[model samples]
Every structure is written in C-alpha cells, then in structure tokens.
Target: MSQKAIIEALKNPDAYDEKVFYVKVLQTHISYIFLTGRYAYKVKKPVNFGFLDFTTLEKRRFYCEEELRLNRRLCGDMYIDVLPITLSDGSVKINGSGKIVEYAVKMKELPQEALMSELLKKGRVDMNVMDEIARILSDFHKKAETNGKIESYGSIDTVRFNWDENFDQTREFIGRTIEHQDYSFIHRAVQEFLKNRKDLFRLRLRKGRIKECHGDLHSGNIFIADRIYIYDAIEFNERFRCCDVASDIAFLLMDLEFLNKSDLSNRFLIKYLEYSGEEEDFLEVLPFYKCYRAYVRGKVTSFKLNDPNITEEEKERSKEIARKYFQMSRQYAEEIF
Candidate 1:
C-alpha cells in the first residue's frame, strides 16, 4: 500500500487491535504518526533529503528498528517495538498475517499534559526540574557508547561538514524565512570558528567526551512523568547522534533560552557540569555548539514551507519562528565570535 492508502486505512479503528474510539493522526517532515487511544504508531515516509533517507521500505524498517534500539537507552519503558503493517485480502491491518506493506514504531501512549513543554508553559518547570533533567542526561552521557570512530565525529572536519550541509540546504529559503545578511554572518562565524579552533575540537576529542547522544533534546521530546522519559532521538544519521557530549547537551540549553528561560538554561548547564564533572573550559566551546543548534532549528522550520499540506497561517507562523531562531543564532555568534 502507498503512504496515502496506509494513512487512510489506519484512520479506522479496525486497523489496530486496540479498541480505539477515534484514531488521531499527526505528521512531521519524515513520518506520519497515528495515535490510537492506547498506543501510537509511526510510519516513515519515502523521502530522502541527503542527510536523512527513508526512501525504501527496507531502509524504513532499519530506521524503525534503530529508533527502537537507540531510544531504549534512556526511555526504555515508553518504546514498545517495531511492528510490520501487513496487507491481507485487500485490508490493511497492523501486525496481521499477510504480506508486509509497511513498518511502524509502536509506542505506549503517554498523556500530552505530561510533556515538559506543556509543563514549562504552565510555570511548572523550575530549577529543580532543570537539575533532574541535567542529572539524567549527565548519567546517560557517562554511560553512552564511544569508540575511535565515534570520537572522530568530534573532529573539526566533521563539524565543518555538518555546518556546511546546513548552509547548503537552507540557501533556497534566504528570502522566505531567513535574511541574506543573517545567513552570511552565520556562515562566516561558523567558518571562522572552525578555522581558528581546530585545537579546541581536538581537545574535545582527546578528552574522550564524544559519545552517542540524544540529538533532539528539546522540551517536546521530554516527558516529566514518574521519570524523565526522553524520546524521539535522531535515529537516521549517526553524524548527528555521535558527537561531543557538550553538543548534545547544548540543544536543551539552547531550547530553554529560546523559551526566554535563560536562568533555567544556566542552572541546567551548571548542574550538568557538576554532575558530569566536565572540565571548566567546557564553557569555552559551548557558544559555538549553541549557535549551530539554533541555526539548524531555523533551517528546519523554514522547510515546513515546502509542505503542501500546511495551511497558509501555519506557514506564516513558521516563517516568524524561523526568523526568531536565526536571530537567536546570530546573537550566540555575536556574543563570542
């Protein structure tokens, strides 16, 4: 079945074994997620944009499995397993006895109100919450896998490769969501940092600070329930996942700053450094990583304009958001470089 057909078929309650009253659907750039009452199933779309590729069924299955495995590192209880959506006698059913038409990452559904973002908006996230999140991440990073190959991703060349790819990808959206001046400045700042700080990158690599990490560590990916359940890691590309631990932690800190909660961001970073026993000079390289994270966020939001399904109002809103992220990137760059 095609993606459209699968989406349409999954809307009915019969598609799932659970007794669902109504099935809700949500989509991101790469996957369509169907939310049953008791569970959620995510199906990757057949799209490849160089950095991320889910163009084939086998590749999708592989990524689905990868998602399950990598996310289990922290939020083990939330991720159930990857299951095949089989087509049988002209009917599409999840995990049915027939030829497999698609793969989905099935997960135990948690309440929306439990998300850290929602809690943040409600003024429920305080310094204590930040400290707990810091401790969780610090512990995870300490135990995270790292080898010579993983440490190499922390090299200056790899850092340049990731930044260059972002610039190349976002060039088309210069006038739409990002200003030409902002793009040029960010490019120059990144290149200058790369050229001048080769030793800093090597210092990070030599510290054995590189490890497989949760690339997407924003508030949305976190659930402040009985425990801190961080989900939806960057599973498609090892380039994003395997990097300096500082780079991984910079994402959430940057996100807090985006929410105008720099106090919490500062507290979180301090707690993380304390818990992890990271070197004091770790602060020296953080602004660069924060700038990288923010600019990539802007580029990602700008890509939403390409989705035909998005309403005009949402596109306009995304444009505003993209601009803000780019501005944040510029601020981070100007602060040091």
Candidate 2:
C-alpha cells in the first residue's frame, strides 16, 4: 500500500486494538503519529536523509524497535510496543495476520496539558517542577550506559566535527534565518574553543562524562505528570544519541532559556551539579555545549522555512525562532570565557 493510503487507513477508530472514539494524525518531516484515545502510534516515513534512513521496510521496522528499546530507558511503560501494519484482502489492520507493510512504535498517550512545553506556555511550571527535572536528569545520566567508544565522542576532534557539520548544514540560511555576522561569530568561537580547550575536553573524557543520552532533551520531550515522562529520544543515529552528558544537559538548558526561562535554566544547572556531585568545573564546559545546542536548534528551525508541507505562518515563526536561537548562541559564545 502507498504511504498516504496507509495513513488514511490508520485514521479510522476501528483500526486500533482498543476502543478509540476518534483518531488524529500529526505529521513531522520524518514520521507520522496517529493519536488515539489512549495510545499514540508513530510510523516512520520512507525517506532517507544522510543522517537517518527509513527508506526500506526493514529499516523502518528496525528503527521502530530501536525507538521502543531506547526510549524504555526513561519511559518503559509509556513506550508500549512496536507493531506492524499488515495488508490483506484490501484491508490494512495493525498487527494483523498479513503481509507486513509498515511498522509503528505504539505508546501510551499522556495528558497534553502536562507537557513541559505546555506548562511553560501556561505559566504553570514552578521551581518544584524544575527541581524534579534536575534530579531526574542527574539520575538518568548516572545510570546511562557508557564505554570507551562513547567517551570518544567527548573528544575535541569529534566535537569539532559536529560543529563543522552544523555550520556547513546551515550555510544556506545565513541571510534568511540567521545574520551573517552572528553565524561567523558562532563558527569562530566554536573553532577557538576546540583549539584552546583541549585540556578541558580531555578532562571531561577522563572523568567519564560521556554516555548514551537522550539526544532530544527539550521541554517538548518532557511531561510533568503523576510521574515525569521523558520520551522521544533519538534512535536513528548513535552518533547523536551517545555524547558528552554536558551536551545532553545543554540541550535542555538551552530549551528553557529559549522559552524565556533563563532563571529556571540557571537553577536547574546548579541543582544538577549538586545532585550529580560534579565539580564546579562542569560550568567551564557548559557554555561551549550550550552554544553548540542553540546553533543546531537555529539550523533545524531554519530548515522548516524550506519545508513545503509547513504553512507560511509556521515558516515565518520558524524564521523568528531561528533568529532568536542564533542570537542566543552568540551570547553563549561570548560567555565561553
């Protein structure tokens, strides 16, 4: 079946195992999420960007399973299972006996109002919530699996490679979403840090700060509910998922700051340090990662301006957000002292 046909088929409440009164579908560039009354099913697009490939049925199935496995680290019960959409007799039924056509990662749906991003927008997030977020993040980092290979990602060379890639990827958006001067400054600042902070990067590696972490650690990926749920981890690439824990921390911190909650970010960082028992030196390397995180956010948001599916208003918003992120990246670069 075609991807569009399968998507249309899945929109029926009858397509699910449990009773669902209605079905709503959300589409991202790489995946489609069908939200039911109690569960959400995510299906990968048969698209291959160089960094991620879900072009083949087998690759989609593999990533569906990988998403379930990796996200189970934080949301074991929420990431329910990986199910196949099968085709038989002109019928497309999920997990039915037929030719496997597509795969989906099924998850228990949580309250949308409880999402960290929503809470921030509603002004419902408090210091207590930030406190819990910090404690949970510290514990997760402590338990995350790490080895020699993971630690190598914290090396200066790898760090340089990532920054260089970010710059190259976003070069086209310089005048559209980011100012040329801001881009040049961020690039130069990152390069200077990589050249002069070899000792600091080596210390992070030696102290074992690298781990298999949640690559997308932002407000949108978190929920403040009965139990905190941090979901939607990066599963397509280990290079993105396995990194210096500081990078993971920086992503969330950059997100809070992006949401105009710099106080929360500052408080979260202090509490995270206290909970993790890391030295004050952790601050020394944080700005570098924060700058990297903000620049990457700018790059990705700017790309939405070119997405044919996104509305023109969304593209305008993306351009505005991307500019803010680049400016924040510049500020962080300036603070790299």
Candidate 3:
C-alpha cells in the first residue's frame, strides 16, 4: 500500500481497537514512526534509496530484525522486538497472526525533552549530560568489534575516496542552494588536505584506529533519560557505520557546535579523551573528521529542496543551513592544515 493510504488507515477508528490501542504518527521520513500507546513502532518505508534498501517485505523484515538487534546493544530495555503487521480482508492489525504485510521495530517511547537536540534548543542542556553521553559512547566504542583483516580503512586512498565521494555527490547542489563562497572554500580545502595527509591516514590505519562505529552519532540521535540512550544506529549498511572511532566522535562534536554549544562540545571531547586515553590521536583527526561530518550535514540539508511537503520558505531556510555547514566544513579543513 502507499504511504498516504497507510497514514489514512491509521487515522480510522475502525482500523484498530479504539479503546485499547491508539496510533499517532510521529515522524515520516525514510521510515514511518508511530506511537502505539506506550511504545513506538518504526516501520521502514518501502523505498530503495541506494544507501538504504527496504523495498521488499523480506528486506524490511531483515532490516527490522537488524535494527532491533543492533539497537539492543545500547538500548536493551527500550528495543523490545520486531513485530509483523498482518493484513486480512482489507484491514491491517498489529501482531494479527495473519498474512504479514509490514514489520515494525517496537521501542519504548522516550520523552521529547530527553533528546539531546530538543534539550539543546531549549537551553536546558548541561555539560554533565554531555560528559555522561561521552562516557557512554566511549565505553561502547571500546567494546565494539573490529576486523583485523580490513586494512583499507586506515589508508590514504580510502580516506580520499570518502571525501571525494561526498563532495562529488554534493557539487551539483553547490551553486543551486549552497553559497558560492562556501563551496569555493570547501573545494580548495579538500584538495589541499588530500595533497598533505597521506602519511597520517596510513599511520592511523596501522594503529587500528578504525573499527565498527555508530555511523550517525549526532545530537538528534542521542537521548538522556534515566540512562543515556544512543539510538537510531545505521543498520542499513555496514560500510557507513564502520570507520575510524575519531570519525564517530566527530559527528557528535560537530552536532554540538552546530547547536551553538561549543562549551559542551569541548567538555564532551575532553571527557571522552580522558576515558579512552586517545586525546592526541583524536586531535590529529578531529579537524578532518569534523569537516566530513559538516559536509554530510550540508548534503542532508540540501535534500530538503526536493521534499514536496516543504514550503518555499522552508527550502530557503534549508539552503541557508546547507551554506552554513559548508562554511563550517571549510573552517575545520583550514584548522587541520
């Protein structure tokens, strides 16, 4: 069924047990998030966006299971299980024991204020929270599995490919939405870094600095309730999530800076370094990784222009955001060299 039809069905009282269950659509992006009473059900959208493929029922089920399994590593109590939505006689029901039409990864619904992005926006965020989050993430990274066989991650060729692919993909949107000044600066900086940092990249690889990590570790993906919850891990692809630990931590640092919380960012970085005993190594890669993270943000913001639901004003705002991130990327690159 189409997304609009699914959304419409959710609003109908006849579609569910009204007294016992209620469905509230929370977020609709790559996935559809619904609040079913105390739990949130995340259903993967049946769209193949190259980077994420969940077009088939089997693929959705597989990813749902993967999401539950990976998320349980951090949020064991919160990530309950993957349940199938059954369709029978033109009606859809959760755990109906009928023909499975869709699957959702059920999770304990966390409060909005608990999310780091929301907390930061309200000026309710504190250094203590960042410190705790850093510690939790550091511990998770320490325990993460690594592949001794894969040596490409630490090589200069691979590092160049990462930056090259990012810029090549985003270059088309440069003059269209992103400011020309910002784009020029980023273009120059990326080229300069590629020319100078070959040895450093190889050294990091030999040191085993690369490992499986949380691909998307921004403020929006973190939560601090009774305990820190690092949710929304990249379960769609291993390559995106598997990288240098510095790159993973860089995402959070960039997010903090973007939120205008540099003090918290500093504190978080310091705390993470203290616990992991890798401050010098982190410093060496921090600027480059921050650049990478900022460019990723620019690309994502630029995508808003393609969203039909977004108004012209919103598209303009997204362009401004994209320009700002591109400028930030340039600044990080300059700092590195």
TM-score of each: 0.98, 0.96, 0.91
**Positional deviation of residue 274's Cα in model 3 after best superposition, in angstroms:** 0.4
Off by over 4 Å in 1: none
Give candidate 1's total backbone clashes. 0
Candidate lDDT values, in order: 0.89, 0.88, 0.78
Rank candidates by lDDT, best first: 1, 2, 3
Model 2, position 190: C-alpha lDDT score: 83
Q: What is the TM-score of candidate 1?
A: 0.98
lDDT, residue 70, model 2: 96
Tens digits of lDDT, candidate 1, 62-166: 999999999999988889999999899999999888999999999988777999989988988889988998999999999999998988888888899999999
- 314: Cα error in model 2, Å: 2.0
The candidate 3 region of ten consecutive residues with least summed lDDT is: 12-21
The TM-score of predicted model 2 comes to 0.96
Name the lDDT of candidate 2.
Answer: 0.88
Model 3 misplaced regions, further than 4 Å: 12-22, 149-151, 309-314
Q: Residue 330, candidate 3: how far off, in angstroms?
A: 1.9
